[model samples]
Target: MWSWVLHRITGVAIFFFLLVHILDTALVRVSPEAYNAVIGTYQTPIMGLGEVALVGAIVFHAFNGLRIILIDFWSKGTKYQKVMFYVVIALWVITMLGFTPRHLINVFSH
Candidate 1:
């Protein structure tokens, strides 16, 4: 189903971001110069777009994952899977539109 496919895709995307984030933090322990260099690369336009995509993926995966948890834990939630699906979609759209441009500008301006 579409939902299963999307959930897997978003989950993978979030995991990838988490890996990069951990690696970036690890660079601080390696050397401040190395960490700064890595940080500097984030200012580029391409990385800025990546940041936007990362945010969208995290938001979507987190919200939908929570919905899945509710369905598993609550009897009433199972009855509303369709409604929750729409809620997840709307939340994703709102978050992407609301955050992406601001984040892109901040990343690029730095």
Candidate 2:
């Protein structure tokens, strides 16, 4: 139940980020000035936090979805679902810890 809820939440979050990313890239076609402005906003603290959340959502969704796929394709995965769940959590934590600071620093330093 918790896994289902988390999968839905992360999937929705990733979809939302994808929409914003598409719009932002499309703005480049509309106007370079507008695109630069949008890009400039990424340096802000709020957007930094959003970036962290975005990375987390993407990582979680990808890893968990892979787990789900393995389960669907093979019965062996059912026995290891609980272990995989912890692996997913660990991966999420490591990804965030390693990437978030670098991402924020790059955004701000630019």
Candidate 3:
């Protein structure tokens, strides 16, 4: 139940992130200075934290997608759905734990 809700939420968040990413990248072709100005804002500590959230969302979404695929394809998938959900969560936590500190250091050191 919660997994379904979170998967949908993360998917929407990722979609919006991609939309913004595309628009920002396109800015370079339209005007280099404007693109640079936009990118400069991303260097802030706040944006750095946003990047952490983005990575967390992506990791969770990806792992949860794989869990969904297993649920659909494996014969015993339904039987172990709850366990698989936990595995997805564990993987997401480990990944974020590894990423957040290094990212914060780089963000703050700059």
Q: Against the hidden reference, what TM-scores do the models get?
A: 0.89, 0.87, 0.98
lDDT of each: 0.87, 0.87, 0.97
User: Which parts of model 1 have CA positions greater than 4 angstroms off?
Assistant: 108-110
Per residue, candidate 3 scores C-alpha lDDT tens digits across 49-74 of 99999999999999999999999999
lDDT by residue (1-110, candidate 2, tens digit) is 68779999989888888899899999999999999999997778888878788788889888889889877887899999888889988988998899988988886785
Error of 2 at 60 (Å): 0.8
Candidate 3 has an lDDT of 0.97
What candidate 2 gets wrong by more than 4 Å, as runs, is: 105-110
The sequence of per-residue lDDT tens digits that candidate 1 reaches over residues 5-110 is 8889989888888899999999999999999999998778898787787787788888899889989998999899889989999999998889977887787687
TM-score of 1: 0.89
RMSD of 3: 0.6
Is 1 or 3 the stronger prediction by lDDT? 3
